[model samples]
Target: MDGQLMAFTGVAAGMVAMPGADFAVVVRNALDTRKAGVATAFGVAGGLLVHTALAVAGLAAVLVAVPVVFETVQLLGGAYLLYLGAGALIAVARHRSAATAPSAGARGEVPGPRPTVRLGTAQYLRQGFFTNALNPKAPVLFLSLLPQFVPAGQPALPRTLLLATIVVGMAAVWFPAVALLVDRLGVWLRRPRVSRALEATTGVLLTALGGVLLAELVLT
Candidate 1:
């Protein structure tokens, strides 16, 4: 691999792998339904494709020109993280309430909405796609960060495509493994206590990530 390519790949992979809204959403879906997780993973990958194409096509340059654009994206990304975190916290609260419900405990009925066949794979996929796609930071990151790694004279299109492929490939490897692991874990992952803790942790992480992004934006 070209040195630049290697560096770029490392950066892209690191960025994608960082636990954020995207990672949280996918893992949540996987734990919720293994099949749906697979679809969600693919959908997130599709959003990456769009970002990669935008970067390679030079559309990102438009974003680079206005400092405000990057700042705006950062703010939006921060807000998104906050929103996701709040949702996770809500799930945790619901889980706790359900677990303690007197009648439910006595009757052995879970207090939450049971997952049904209605929560199909397509819905998860669509959720994943929209969640990642709607987040402004994703495309902005590709636009702002990716070009920095491209060599001065190289055909950016090929380089950009290569970078995107490698990053997405890494995600393909990591998330399905997560899905399979969750599948194998079976009922353990579905336990109310387990779900509540997971959601709570994810919520905290998202909030922290958002705070960091917001600070970075303010400083920049």
Candidate 2:
């Protein structure tokens, strides 16, 4: 069992390292505020808990077996991403407009650094949670991955739970590590031009990913 767990750990590590929409969300938020990034990172971990529960309770199989259920998850996931992406792009436009618009600076008053949205902790956490929870891929991965790791002739529940916990633990560590690294670079990332450019790019990437999900659902 130790050897099996070791192998599973390696596989989990690889999966955690793979950049996905979760990584994008973390980076995007982290670039804005370190605390937001950290909160988002753990919120994703919390999402893994949701998947773990579904997988453990064997609802994931139901999700997979029912085409309607799977499609609904896909639809929701795609729509959520699209919503976030559109929001980011809209923020960029508004910020740019604000920068150029006539303001008190036009008079003798000195202008302050342009105001930007600073999401509260709970809101950031929700952003992170929904970003991961809505994605069908995590549930699918949990459902498939855990069973493979459980050794033959062993009680499945305990082993499955342990393995799921491992995946969640890795996510807890890995995503936050990413957020911290990005935070360390906050000095430069917070700069207006660089920040806005990255924000716009992340937005486009998210929107494209969402589109791909919807397209795949259609094609499938």
Candidate 3:
């Protein structure tokens, strides 16, 4: 059991450290606010729980067996990424417009209100959850990876749950740490030019990722 657990932890840690859509979303949210970053992290963990449930319930096998279902999930996930990317780009445009426009106050000298960042807690959570949940690769990950660690005589479901729990815990730790680090840099990153650049970069990356996923679906 100890050996199995150690292996599981190593694998989970590696996965958590890998830069992917989840990491991108967390970094983007962290630039907005620490709370947004944390919320996104927890939401991603929640999505993992859903994946774990599906894997344990044997639904992951069904997905793998059905090509259409798998492709549909891929398409949906890709579309969501495109949606997020477009929204980010739009935000960049709005911020640029606001920066260039002077406010007309009573004295004609008051500063304009800062653009309200729309990343509320629920939005953060939903973005994270959908980003993680919609990816067909997540289910495939668990389905392929968990069985390798199951002890020969042990029940698969319980063992899979235990391993999945380890992954969830690892994500909970790693993402919050990322949020804190990014938050520390918020002072510089929040500058209008820097923020716009970051936003644009994130938007481009997400859109490109979405395109790649959709291309794979089409080619396969």
On lDDT, the leading prediction is: 2
Residue-pair clashes per prediction, in order, are 0, 0, 0
lDDT of 3 at 23: 86
> Per-residue CA lDDT of candidate 3, range 56-157, in tens?
888999999999999999999999998888878888888777666655343465343335466679989999899989988999999998899998999988
> Could you give candidate 2's per-residue lDDT for residues 176-201 as a string of tens digits?
99999988987787776777887888
- Give candidate 2 misplaced runs (Cα > 4 Å): 100-114
Alpha-carbon RMSD, candidate 1:
3.6
lDDT of 2 at 163: 88
Q: lDDT for each of the candidates?
A: 0.72, 0.87, 0.85
Q: What is the lDDT of residue 40 in candidate 1?
A: 79
Residues 1-220, model 1: lDDT tens digits: 7788788777766777776677777777776778877787877777677777777787667766778876776687677677767877777776677668798789987565323233677777776665566566666677777667778998877777777778778777766676677667858876766767776887888778778788888787
Which candidate would rank higher by lDDT, 1 or 3?
3
- TM-score per prediction, in order, is 0.76, 0.90, 0.89
User: Per-residue error at 28 for model 3, in Å?
Assistant: 1.2
**Among all candidates shown, the one with the greatest TM-score:** 2
* List of clashing residue pairs for candidate 1: none
> What is the Å distance of residue 83 in model 1 from its true position?
3.6
